[model samples]
Target: AELEIERWKNENAPPNLPELKEHLQTKKTAFVLQEKRLKRLRLLIDSNKFAEARSEISQWKKTGEDLSGLSEMILNLEHIEKSDDIVLDLKRGLAWQKYPDSYIQNLKMAVDRCKSIQSIPRKSFNWRIPSKDELLLFFTSNIESKVQYNSGSYWSSTTDKVWSDYNWIVESKSSSLVRTLKDDYKFVICVTDASSEMIYHYLDTLKF
Candidate 1:
């Protein structure tokens, strides 16, 4: 029967081999991503980190990512948290994950280490300081009252290539864009791809 099925597949093969190959490659790429997710889920389950696994599943659902077998996995585990609740917890986190490291110094170091958490949400947060433009927008936006940060300047991803010693920051008091030494102590908030409401909720509680 398997041999007959192979014969049937061969007979149905497209004449455009290049296009067929491209299609097959796309499927393979998707399959690889799915496999990684499954592996991560399994590891989480085995390690008994059910909340994190649920969080991952919720994040995927929020982003509309394909969750091929995740629902079944959750069922198998007897996880009682409703999908809505799981999503709510994630929303509470702002989907803005605080890195395990409380404080990190220097822009280069922050960039290098922050990439490690990409596997959590199955997407990279791309931990970066807000740009001057982004910071200005944040301050001027209607959510300004809700938006809060530490008492001093926080680093912005913007850098002065000409002046290698300085980096830009958003001043907390005036919301003015200014330059400062990267070596200074400044609170950091990683970026997130959370939903609009989640993002707004996050901006309200942002802290050092």
Candidate 2:
């Protein structure tokens, strides 16, 4: 009778028990690690180490971790930062950031950093190199003459459609439009529509 009952229990047991156990263990381990990370991030935030916290989140994303909850929290923090930003308004429904250089100096890095803001439109620019004609006309205009700015080379978003590797450029000293390779990094000045939030989060770290 004992032997018969043992055989019955075995037959009724769930199939693939080993696989299920492995999967459950994997999930448990992941949960534990996630909890540890969450605690660390919270500590970082409380300590006013937001940059480190943001860097940690970025590292996790690069590792392909599911960070939706953390990302949402960070977004809330960014919103607070945005509200505190010094947004400058200009004529003709235009907005400009007070500082010229971006937190990340490279063109691609600048663009990518600009794109991270959810409060603003997608692919929003904090700075861009003005077009040759635009820069020329701008500097030549009475309005530009009144404003004191240094003459330098700046990066423009205008890329040659026919040549994917080339981009248009403007020199503050002259009005001619020039073409350059995409890899060359140059100075950038950002502008936005009047409605944009124009948050420059890294500006606080800058001395100027």
Best by TM-score: 1
Can you list the residue pairs that collide in candidate 1? none
**Local accuracy of candidate 2 as per-residue lDDT tens digits, 102-158:** 322456755654454444433333334445545555545544544334566666777
Clashes by residue pair, model 2: 126-190, 127-190, 128-189, 129-155
As a TM-score, model 2 comes out at 0.40
**Residue 206 C-alpha lDDT in model 1:** 27
Stretches of candidate 2 off by over 4 Å are 1-91, 102-104, 113-137, 142-150, 195-208
lDDT of each: 0.51, 0.52
The best candidate in terms of lDDT: 2
On the 0 to 100 scale, the lDDT of residue 74 in model 2 is: 51
Question: What TM-score fits each model?
Answer: 0.40, 0.40
